[model samples]
Each structure stands twice: as C-alpha cells, then as structure tokens.
Target chain A: MREVFHQSLEDVQSRLVEIAELVTVAIERATKAFGTSDVTLAEEVIEADQVIDDKAIELDELAIQILARQQPVARDLRIVVAALRVSASLERMGDIAEHIAQLTRMRFPERAIPKGLKSTFTKMGEIDVQVANLLTEILRTEDLALVEKLRTLDDQLDDLHLSVFEKVLSENWQGEAGATVDATLASRYHERFADHALSVAKKVAYLATGEWTPDTDSIAVIVAADLAAVRENADGAEA
Target chain B: MREVFHQSLEDVQSRLVEIAELVTVAIERATKAFGTSDVTLAEEVIEADQVIDDKAIELDELAIQILARQQPVARDLRIVVAALRVSASLERMGDIAEHIAQLTRMRFPERAIPKGLKSTFTKMGEIDVQVANLLTEILRTEDLALVEKLRTLDDQLDDLHLSVFEKVLSENWQGEAGATVDATLASRYHERFADHALSVAKKVAYLATGEWTPDTDSIAVIVAADLAAVRENADGAEA
Candidate 1:
C-alpha cells in the first residue's frame, strides 16, 4: 500500500509538470500571436485552452481520488492539497493566455500591441514566457532556487506593466480610446500571467520548505501606489 | 470518531460562512467608496483586507489539520477538500474588494467611476454587493436554490462589464487616459468578484449534486466575443 501511494504521488507530480508545460506553450504562442498579429496562432491558443482546462480538471480528480483511496496524511496530504491549488493557478495562467489571444483575434487586421507601447509589451510578453518556463522547470525538478528566479522575473513584469500605464497616461500619448483599452487590458493580462506563475512557484516552495506564505493579491495595492506616484510626478513636471 | 468528524465538518462550514460575511462587508464598503470617492472608506476596506487574508490562511490551516487528523474518506474527504477551494475563492473575493478600494483611493478626490459611465459602474457595484450577500447566505444555508439566483446576478454583472467596454470604445467617449484605465481595471475587478462567487456556488452545488463542472475562465472569452460583435455592429452602423 505504501508503494502504491508513492506511485500515486509521483503521478500527481508528473501531471503538474505536464500541465505547467502546456501553460508554457499557451503563453508562448499567445504572446507571439499578440506581437505579430497572427490571428491563426491566436485562434489556436484559444482552442487549445480547453485542453488545458480539461487537464486541470483531470488532475483535480486524480488528487481527490488519491485523497479518498490513499488517505494520505500529514505531508502527503498537504502535497495533494497543494497540487489542487497549483492546478487552479495554472488553469488561470492558461486563461490569461486565452485572454491575450482573444485580444489579438479581436483586433485581427490591426495590431493588439497598441501604438507606442510595442517594445514594452514585447518585453513583458517575453518575460512572461520565461516565467512560465521556469515554473515548469521548478515543478518538474523541485528546485527551490528557481522559485526566486521566477520571483525576479515577476517583479520585472510588474515594472513593465507599470510602464505600460505610464505611457498610456502620459500627456504626449496619442492613441485612440480603443488602443488605450487594449493596452490596459493586455498589460494586465501579461503581468497577471507572470503573477500566477510566481504563485505556483511559491506553492512548490511551500511543499519543500514547509513555510507557507498566504497567497493574496496584495501586490496590486503596492503596484497601484507606485503607479499613482509615477503619475503624480509626471503631472508635477508638466505643471 | 464519526461524531468528531461531523463536528469538524460543521466547524469548517461555519468558518466559511464567517469569512463570506466579511467579504460581503468588504465589497459593500469598497463599492460604496468607489462610487462616492470616499477615500477613508476605501482605506478602511484596504486595511481590513489583511484580516480577511489572515482568516483565510487560518481556515486553510484548519482544513489541513482536519485532513491530517481525521483521514476522512468518500464524501467526508471531498467535503474537506471543497472547503479549501471555497476558502480560496472567498479570499479572492475579498482581494477584489480591496482592489476596488485601491482604485478609489488611488484616484482620491477624483471619482473613479470615469465620466459618462457612473450609472453603469454604480449598477455593477450594487449587483456585486448583492452577489456577495447571496453567496454568504448560500454558504450558511447550503440552499442550492440560491445558486441559480447568484448565477443570474453574475450574468447581470457580466453585461455591465461588457457595457463598460462598449462605452469606452464608443466614438462618443470623451474621457482621457486616466478615466479609461480606471474604468478598465475597476470593471474587471467588479466582474471578477462575481465570478469568484459564482464559482463557489458551483462548488456548493457540486457537493450536493455530485456533478462537477470544470472551473475555467471561459466566461471571459465569451464576453470578449460579445464585445467584439457589439463593436463591429456599431462600426457597421457608422459606416
């Protein structure tokens, strides 16, 4: 029975890594589509999102079954519970990718990168893709070091997210209402993708170190404050 | 042993209800602050969010402990696992309320509703508050009938969310970049709060009905498509 339970745990880990890899692909393709305005690739990401959703559901069922059958206690039980959360976060990351794809598709002939913020978005997308990859690696190998690396990338993505807002809110900005809307939504999607990845990384870290951090959206408040300061400084300079 | 497990389950249920009540209050205050530009109220919501966060963590610890000590199986095990998911969703609902408050405080002395869309956001905020209240009642009563009502409110919130984008993208829009950003972020936060509530409702329904629906962000994609259609039709009429 112990050996069987051990195999079940391994199954959970591999499935998590598998879902993470798929999320990585989804973000990579979605970002590429957003950058190049490849509607076909964007459509692909949209359709493939269902697969990720299904995989997450399947993983959840497996975790529950393990709980019911193996009756894992203590650390083993925590591992299964953590898998449930990691799957949810991964599913959300896939959804963000789909949102990015939908943005590209919504703007078909036109670029979704919006005018004057292409480089910032491109950088943000690249960083998000890297974050996804690192998340997959961390889950696959259980290396705590990758969690810190992922956190750094998430910080960078947050900064880029702030920059996107700064550009849009600048006095010299000339984009139309549609462009502004797209920039705001798209930057948020990109930044949130990395945020979800970092969240998954933290869960993995918790399973290893046994020091759990409460996962809350406190980052938004800090980011919002920084944005307000930057906007105020810009306004003061203009005055 | 069975009686002890039953008691543990009841404890989980009551704690969930407690957290849900706090969320209802948070959304109430946050939305009120957002609509009236009450920065102090917004700050209150923001400061109080940590309590919700801490409570969620405490609840999670309790759930983990139950899982470890009881080693429940079948429906009992599923109940504990579902409690964890529900707690996470409730925590997220609290975070969304905080985000709304942050928006209000960030634009203090300046209304966060954006010009020309005050009524839309006001309605959205009210529906969200209603949604939170209903979610708390449902958790307390386990009345699956309320789930349908919750779904209806969520649909209303989604429409309002779509309309915010429609107003922003319309040619009649006169708001500058700041208003656009706030509308985009604020609308998203309001819609997501309802979405999280609906998700919890579904989980409750699942617990009773034993029918599991995959919880994915498919709603965003559908809403995005609807917005696109609305935009195209408007453009066609203009042409």
Candidate 2:
C-alpha cells in the first residue's frame, strides 16, 4: 500500500509536468502568433487549450484520490496540496495563453501588435516563452536552482511591461487610442503570464523547502510561514 | 472525536464568512474612494488590505489543520477544499480592490475616472458592492436562492465593463492614453472582483450539490460538474 501510494504520487507529479509542457507549447504558439499576426497558429492555440483543461481536471481527481487513500501528513500532504495548486496555476496559464491567442485572432490580418512596438512585443514574446520553458523545466525536475532564475525572468518582463507603457505614453507617441489600448492589454497579458510562472515556481519552492508562505516577499514569507507552522504544531499538541 | 471534528468544521466555515465580509468592506471603501477621488479613503483601503491577507492566511491554516486531522471524504472533504478556494478567491478580490485604490492613489486629486463615465462607474460600483454583499450572505447562509442573484450581478458588471470599453474606443473619446489605460484597468478590476464572487458562489453550489465543475459558467459548469462527478464515481468503484 505504501508503494502504491508513492506510485500514485509519482503519477500526479508527472501529470503536472505534462500539463506544464502543454502550457509551454500553448504560450509559444500563442506568442508566435501575436508577433506575426498568424491567425492560424492563434486558432490552433485556442483550440488546444481544452487539452490543458482536461489534464488539469484529471490531475486534480488523482490528487484527491491520493489524499483519500493515504491521508498523508507533513511533507507528503504539502506535496499533494501543492500539486493541486500547480495544476490550477498551469490551467490558468493556459487560459491566459488562449486569451492572448484570441486577441491575435481578433486583430488578424490587421496585426494585433502595431508597427513601432513589434520589436518590443518580439522581445516580450521571447522572454515570455523562455519563462514558460523554465516553468516546464522546474516542474519536471523540481530544481530549486531554476527558481531564482524565474524571478529574474519575471523582473525582466516587468521592466519590459513598464517600457511598453512608457513608449505608449511617451510625448512623441502617435498611435490611436485603440492601439494604445491593445498594447496596454497585451503587455499586461504577457507580464501576468510570467507572474503565474513565477507563482508556480514559488509553490514548488515551498514544497521543497517545507515552508508555508504567509506573505509575498520570499524572506518575509518564509520566516512568517515558519512561525505559523511552529504555532500550529503547538496548537495541535494542545488540542 | 466526531463532535470535535464537527466543531472544527463549523469554525472553518465561519472563518471563511468572516474573510468574505472583510473583502466586502474592502471593495466598498475602494470603490467609494475611486468615485470621489478620496485619497484618504483610498489609502485606508490599501493599508487595511494587510489585515485581509493575515485573515486569509489564518483561515487557510485552519482549513489545512481540519483536513489533516479529520481526513474527511466525499462531501466533508469537498467543503474543506471549497473553503480553501473561497479564501483564495476572497484574498484575490481584496488584492484587486487594493489595485483599484492604488490607482486612485497614483492619480490622486486628479480623479482617476473621467467625468463622462462617472455615472457608469457609479452604477458598476453599486452592483459590485451588491455582489460583494451577496458573497458575504451566501457564505453565511449557504442559501442557493442567492446563487441566481450572483449571476445576474455578474452579468450587470460584464455589461458595464463592455460599455466602458465601448465608450473609450468610441469616436468622441478625448482622453489621452493615460486615462484610457486607467479606465481600462479599473473597469477590469471591478469586473474581476464580481467574477471572483460569482466563482465562490459556484464553488459553494457544487459543495451543496456534490458536483465537480469543469469551468466557470454556472449552469453549464454545474451540468458538466455533475457528469464529471458521475464519471469519477464510476472510476472509483471500478478501481
């Protein structure tokens, strides 16, 4: 029974990595479509998002079953709970990718990205795909080494997102209100996509580190989580 | 032991409703400050957000303890899981409200919203507060009758959100990129706030009904949830 439980746990982990791969492909295709106004690629990305959704649902049920069967405690329990969260995050990442694709499909032929900002979008798209790749890698290997790199990537995206804003709101800007809106929303999508990737990595970090974050900043969150865990253990003993 | 478990479960449920109420007040003050350009109120909302965060973390730890201790299955497990999701959604709702207030803070004394859309935003704000109130009520009463009201409220917010986009994109628009971006993001915050409330409602409905939703459109999601639950049950029995 113990071996079986671990097998099911392994299955859940692999399923999460699989979903991360699909999410990576979705973001890659969706961003490629965004940069080139490739409506066909955009359509494909949109249609394929259903697969990610189905995988998430399947992974969720598997995790729930494991919980019911083993009633795991401590790190094992955290791992299963984190699996559910990672699946949801990946599913949301896919949905965001689909939304980006929809934006591409909406402006098809006309180009969702304007001419002046194409290179910027190109940069953002490249960085976003890289972030997505990092997500897949980290999920696959559970490597803490890759965790710090995601924050750097997310910081890069934030800088790029802000630059997009500055360019649009610059004194010499000539784009219409519509283009400005498009640029703003699209930049936000890519930035948030990176944010979600970073979020998943943080969850994995917590799982590996055996901590529960009580806040956003890593140091403070870890310290607070440790305090909370100690307090909870005392409470549990008392109860 | 059963009595202790039931007591703990009730404690978890009440904590969730408490978080919901805090979310309610946060949205109310944030939107109120947005309309009036009341920077003080906006600042208050922003500062008060940490309390919501602390409460959510507290609620989550409590739920995790219940799960680890009780090892609940079926409906009881669903309720605990739903509480976690609800706390998350409420926390997110608070964050969005904080974003709205931060916008007000960023554009203080200048009124982040334009005069033309004031009435529209006013209407939207009223509905958002109503939606927030409904969230508090449903979390408290678990009254499925209020469930229908949330969909209606969400539709209202959606309609208002669309109108904001339409007005900004219309030919008469004179606002610069800054105001346009502000309008776009602020409207989205409100729309998403309502969206989260509706989501918590759907989760509660599933808990009440023992369904497993595949998506967010309540009726269709509920139907799909039912089918998924049936399939999962068959899979469990077969296993």
- Model 2: share of real contacts kept: 0.32
After the best TM-score superposition of candidate 1, give how far the Cα of residue B162 lies from its true spot, in angstroms. 1.1
Which numbered prediction scores highest in lDDT against the true structure?
Answer: 1
Deviation from native of the Cα of residue B56 in model 1, angstroms: 1.0
lDDT tens digits by residue: candidate 2, B1-239: 88998898899888888888888899899999999999999989888889999998888778778778889887787787778778888988998888878777767667878757899888888898999999899999999999899989988887787677667766667988777777877887788898888888989988888775556333322322333344344345546
Whole-structure CA lDDT of model 1: 0.90
lDDT tens digits, residue span A1-239, model 2: 88998898889889998999999999999999998889999989888989999999888888778878788877788788778778878988898888788778766567889658988889988998999899989988989999899889888877777667667656556887667777877888888898788889988988888665443533222322333344344335546
Task: State candidate 1's DockQ.
Answer: 0.80
Clashing pairs in 1: none
lDDT of candidate 1 at residue A141, scale 0 to 100: 95
User: Which residues of candidate 2, in runs, are more than 4 Å off?
Assistant: A213-239, B216-239
lDDT of 1 at B159: 91
Lowest-sum lDDT 10-residue window in model 1 chain B: B212-221
Interface Cα RMSD, each model: 1.1, 10.7
lDDT of each: 0.90, 0.80
